[model samples]
Target: MSDTATVYRQRASARPRIEAEPPIRHVAVVGGGTAGWMTALLLAHSGYGPRLQVTVLESPQVGIIGVGEGSTSWLRGFFEELGIEESEWMPACHATYKSGIRFDGWSTRPGHESYFHAFASMLDNLTMTQFVDHVHRRLDGEDVHAHPDRYFLATRLAHACKAPRPRHEFPFDVWYGYHFDSVLLGAFLQRKAVERGIRHLPRHVVAVDRNERGDIASLQLEGGETLAADFFVDCTGFAGLLIDKTLQTPYVSYADALFNDAAVAMPTPLDGPIMSQTISTALRHGWAWTIPLTRRHGNGYVYSTAFCTPEQAETELRTQLGLLDADVPAKHLRMRTGRVEQHWHRNCLAVGLAQGFIEPLEATALMLVQRTASLFVDALEKGDLGAAAQATFNTAVNAQFDGTRDYIVAHYKTNTRTDTDYWRANAANTRLSEPLTRLLKTWLARRPIVGGIQQGTFGQGYPVMSWYSLLAGMGLFPDDGELRAPAAHEPPHSLAAIDNLIQRSALNFPDHRELLGAIPPRPREESLQVYFW
Candidate 1:
């Protein structure tokens, strides 16, 4: 070679080479559903290339709890990262846009019985400071309208039955999620993962085998075949096959904090314009969720079996839906509300219902699954699944689950309803996590909640705006008689101005139904292959 060419070759040889093989060559995800498929897909997309093999061993006999589901904005990021288009999966899954949740009858306080918990948006930055200021003013006896619904653009869009998808000309981005058929979503994800070269085994996992280190060594199939991998993912729903049954991990229940334990779900015909919001109405026993899909409305009554029987819940739900005499069947689900002591144990990581479930009060099920799968991928890539890395991952995941529990528990604890024994019990019960207690203390003391959360080790699941919305929406404030006028120098916080801004901003989005209609149907060939998984 020439002198210049020889020098360039030497310099190139000195550079570090990328590792072609990942530390964990193969990962076996046991169970199939949204969690299983999602875990598989995320692993396949984790930049490990063909070196990291992913296998999903799903039981054909185990039916998925295909309830109507809503997700947080995390799911939008999930799809975007996977290069899946809204038009592609949304249409196939019978999905619709969700701006946020509309809570009704959770409180009996006048003018505060209903509130909207909106997903945070870029536009919130424009008004959050003023909103927080008004909240402080209202707490200090000023006659300010600090209701969160009036302050958020998502609430406005939801009220107007508008999609969160802003027009191309709209400068700011609006973050939102979706309501979809869970079964379809799982299938869609499975297809995507399979197309990306992930292996799928439609076989029953009859037994789990452990090595000398007590790590999951292999899974025994029904016909005596064995499937082994370097790592294992437990997506076995609430059964927690590997994490709970196999690993013998300890479970910490949240029964003292959250009372509702059972849910009865049934579908209702779409009766009106599709709304871009989930409706959570407090019922006699617990609460009812109304999730609107493109084809139907998914309605469920989540209550405590200790308070109401399955038949009673179904009857109440039927009464609510005006289907008391209708032949529509309701699917009842028993929920275990809590988390494992450790999410990542040994060579196994748990995802989905197997990880633990808080009541679906906030539609956080799928969001948690997404977080777990993504976090596990990052942990594995960074530390090659070492003990220290596992400990750190467990801490983060456990914190998230506990934090979510605290938030959901607050929903019940702060409820202003006393009509039912259940509601009364929730309000009277004092079993609260330290973080929630401190945060509540901060709010009641008229201190800055944001500061309290920032200062302490608060659960990092929900944002500060969410806490503000929940507490303020429930009218958890001092009595009006205790109020006094603002100081002369205090600048007025105009409710009309906020309203005007939100109203005008909402106009930038299209009607919810129209937006759903705009998404063209998936190709016939793809639709035909949807169930191939």
Candidate 2:
């Protein structure tokens, strides 16, 4: 043999064999809601061994805080991944397509000033920086009265109250989310998960037991049965049954940045045309989210208790919806704006409200749970994930939470509304993270661009275009005279092309109502009687 071959053979013979770590054969998820059920289903669908088992321990007495009624488009991919058909679930949950969110009366200008944060844009071919610069220049010149929504095809669809037909092959991508009944959604997911062989137990966890190594060993159910698993997932909402109360994870609060802590939600009978999007109308001391579903409307007033009372908020919501003097029952929700510093501990992981909560400003509750469970699934796929993987998961999840918190804070910090003490206090709040601070300073000097202040890879929560919309919507950008001049480089297409794109798509796409009518209607379950988050 050659010298190298002889050396390799000798070294291999001298080395000792190492054993692989044991795989996680069983996973026990505590709590049940959209988050717990989604995690269980995902794990069951991950193609683990037949011996691998997943069980969901849901309480029979706990109620669901049906506040996650709105969702981001990310859930669409999640559904597609799990082999779920839109046709079946949409009607089952009384769902509707959400093209985007429209913020009405958000600007300081007098009269009806509003803007849209659209999901789909026709400018997909252009870099985000290019789009931002073009819109900034246009706003400075002839389009001084322009809104960023003018550049998004989805905005046109939403405004026209139209939807793209599923059968038609479109050149551009169609982006959308859903507005659904959260409680109904949970029921649907629970049925699906149970059908797929995941054990669904309606039992409360009364006690938690841990191994000597500090990993979760088992859970004691209310009926005196002990359940053991190789790993545990905490989806116990604010209770944090496993990750927080048992593991003793540290937490970081966003209260200093995001002031809203209380919400009062009420549903109104469907009295008007169902819109194709979520409408967030700004209030004097808070904001009201109007989510239109096939059955009824989900409305809520999110405000800071520091500035407004719960009774005052409920009155404002009723008045805004023209239900003044109407004796309507309202549901109240209390929240703490914070997240655990570490989501994954020795052998336990927290998902959804158990991990953290930053309010529903961006409808991130469901999406965050999806992402957290997905990350844990990925770690499992890498054979054995020990301390290194735990550390990495915590770091990534923290960044996403903190990044989303900063984005929500920006809405308040950049607002020009000083009409109320709440607005004034929010605008003057001095607890901005350094990253957002740098970004806002840069935006003042010029327009925002992709990757400017966002954490994680592209396509994470709140992209650059979103920042531009919020800033321009609030009139926080520098004055036209001081704004940076457009880049000398020309755009690839003329403005007329964008207009043509919107016009052609609008003509081909069906009206939103027309599409909803086509979904072979199922008998609606008596509308869910519940309050909002």
TM-score of every candidate: 0.93, 0.87
Candidate 1 lDDT over 296-326, as tens digits, reads 9999999999898999999999999999999
Considering every candidate listed, which one attains the maximal TM-score? 1
Alpha-carbon RMSD of each model: 8.7, 9.7
Off by over 4 Å in 2: 1-22, 110-112, 121-123, 126-130, 136-146, 164-167, 451-460, 480-494, 520-533
Collision count of model 1: 0
Residue 171 accuracy (lDDT) in model 2: 36
lDDT against the true structure, each candidate: 0.83, 0.74
Q: How far is candidate 2 from the true structure (C-alpha RMSD, Å)?
A: 9.7
